[model samples]
Each structure stands twice: as structure tokens, then as C-alpha cells.
Target: MEKNKAYFVVILIQLIYTGMFLLSKAAFDVGMSTCIFVFYRQAAGTLILVPFAFITEGKDSSPLTFMTFCKIFGLSLLGITTSLNIHGIALKYTSASLAAAASNCLPAITFFMACLMRFESIKLRTSSGIAKFTGIVICMGGAATMAFFKGPELRLLLHHHLLPSHAQLNVAEGSGSGSIWVKGVFLMLLSVSCWGVWIVLQVYNS
Candidate 1:
């Protein structure tokens, strides 16, 4: 039952992320500044989590050292601020689905980073290791496909005709060159890499 609940939570988180990508793209279309969006996002997250951390763990936790504080700050900078800023910029040039597709690389990137940091072991002779390696390879391949292949256009059921004129204009403005798509892909990859680093650091600190 507990395992089932955990799986449900993971699925819920993915749904939330999907919504975030779509909603963020809409926000960008309305001329929201990426930097300002990131600033408020980080601020809000800090406000929420700080109090929760204090309430839940403050009494039980040991005092934080200067080194520990630095690590936590670095993680926040890379994971929250840098990642979200890049994501916002990328969304301006690419579709929400494209951005979400690129994000599928996150787990694979995190796995490799953890291996590099000696936090995860890989034994090629073992079945589990082989499966893990294969899955990572597949994920990387999918990310590459998303980066290079434009594929067929997916028409929405509601259609562009239903959208406001300004929204249509925004969509048209954002649509263009292969170069812009490639740039967005690179930015997303960079953002995911930063997130992967944060994951490794978080594990180390914990």
C-alpha cells in the first residue's frame, strides 16, 4: 500500500510538471519576463520550504556549518534559479511539449552524474546494470531525437482558430528557424545538466 502510494505521488508530480510547462508557455506568450518569473518562483519556494523545514526538522537537526550552508546555497542557485531561468528562455523559443520531452533526459543525466561521484555502482556483467545502462542510452537517444527532428505537426483539437488574435500572433512570432529550436534544445540540456548536478550534491549533503 505504501509503495502504491509512492508511485501515485510520482505520477502526480509528473502531471504537475506537465501543467507547469504548458502554463509557463502561456505566461511567456503574455510577455512575462523570464528573469522576473524566476525571481518570484525562487522567492516563493524559499518562503514555503524554509518555514516547513524549520517546523519539521529544526528542533531535531544539528547546527549547520559554514561549509554546509555554502553547499545548500550553491544547490539552490544551480537547481532553482539557473534551471528555471534557462527553462523560461527556452520556452519562449520552443513548444511546451518539446521542453518536456527534453526533460526526460534528467534521470539519465542524474544517474551518470551519481556514478561519476561514486554514489552509484555499475557492474556491466549484471542484468540490473545492463538494464540501467540500456535505459539511459534510450533516454539519451530520445532527447537527441527531440533536438534534431521536427517531425509532423500535431494539431490541437481546439485549433488555433479558437485562440485570441494576440495568442495567434504570439504563436506565429515564436515559430521559425531550425536554429531557434536547436538553441532551445541546448538551453534545456544545460538546465537539465545543472539539475543533475544539484541532485548529486543533494545526495552528498544528505
Candidate 2:
């Protein structure tokens, strides 16, 4: 039952991410300002999570030091604020599907960084290590392809149009623009790299 619950939670999280990607892209298509969208998104998250965090962990947690507070502030600025801003801009120039697919690189990049930092070990002679290495290679290659190639267009999932014709056309054109797509891919990859570094840095905080 515990394992089942974990699986359910994972599935739920993926569904939520899918919805976010779709909605965010739709908003961008409809001419929403990426900066304002990111601001509202972050503000909403803070409103939802801060109260719960204060109630559950405030009393038990040690008083934060000035230096520690600075570290956290810097980390949030590097990891969350900058990353999300770049991601939102990238989403403006690329399709949500590409954004979602590129995000899968996060764990791979994190693991590679951890290994480089000596926080994780891998023995390439071992089966598991080889599999991990192979997966990472594939992920990097896929990201490169996404950045450099403008593949054939994919058919829409729904037969009926959900967005206005202009919005749909804008989305399609954005995805197909070689220069803009490359720029978006590079930004997205940079954002993922920053996030991976953030994940690694969390160890020091803990």
C-alpha cells in the first residue's frame, strides 16, 4: 500500500505538471506577459506554501542566521527566480511539449553534477552504472536535437480547436521558427542547469 501510494503521488505530480505546461503555453499564446505570468505563479505558490510551512516547521526550526538567510536568498534568486523567468521566456518561443520533454533532463543533469562533486559514485563496469551512463547520454543527445533541429510538425491531440485560430497559429509558428526555437532551447537548457545546481546545493542546507 505504501508503494502504491508513492506511485499514485508520482502520477498525480506528472498530471499536474502537464496541466501547468498546457495552461502556461495557452496563456503565452494569448499574449500574456511572461514576466507577469511568472510573478503571479510564484506569488500563488508562496501564498499556498508559506502558511503551511510556518505552521508545521516554524516552532521546531532553529532561528535563521543572517548568513544563512543570505545563502537562502541567493539560492532562491539563482534557482527559482532566474530559472523560472528563463523557462517562461523559453516557453514563449517553444511548444509546451518541448518544455515538458526538456524538463526530464533535470534529474540526469543533477545526478551527473553530483557525481562530479563526489557526492555520488558510479562504477561504469557495473550494469547499473552503464545503464545510468547510457540514459544520460541519450538525454543529452535528445536535448541537443531539440535545440538544433526543427522536425516535422506533430498533429494536435484534439481534433477540435481549443484555442483561437490566431493563438493556435502563433503557437505553431513559434515552435517552427529555427532561430527562435534554438534560442528557447538554449535558455531552457541553461535554466535546467541552474536548477540542477540548486538541487545539489540543497545538500549543504540540509
Candidate lDDT (C-alpha), each: 0.83, 0.84
> Candidate 2 lDDT, tens digit per residue, 1-206?
88799899988998898899889988988899998999999999999999999999999999989989999998999899999898999988877877877888998989988988889888899999999999999998887776677677666854566755444664567564777787888888888988888899889677
- Writing each residue's lDDT as its tens digit, candidate 1 over 1-206 gives 98799899988988988998987887787788989987887788889899899999999999889998998888889898888899899887777887888788999999988998899988899999999999999999987887787776655744565333345644665567567778888898888888898989898888
Please provide TM-scores, in order, for all candidate models, with all chains considered together.
Answer: 0.85, 0.87
Task: Give the CA lDDT, 0 to 100, for residue 27 in model 2.
Answer: 91
TM-score for candidate 1: 0.85
Model 2: clashing residue pairs?
Answer: none
Candidate with top lDDT is 2
Q: CA shift at 130, candidate 2, in angstroms?
A: 0.7
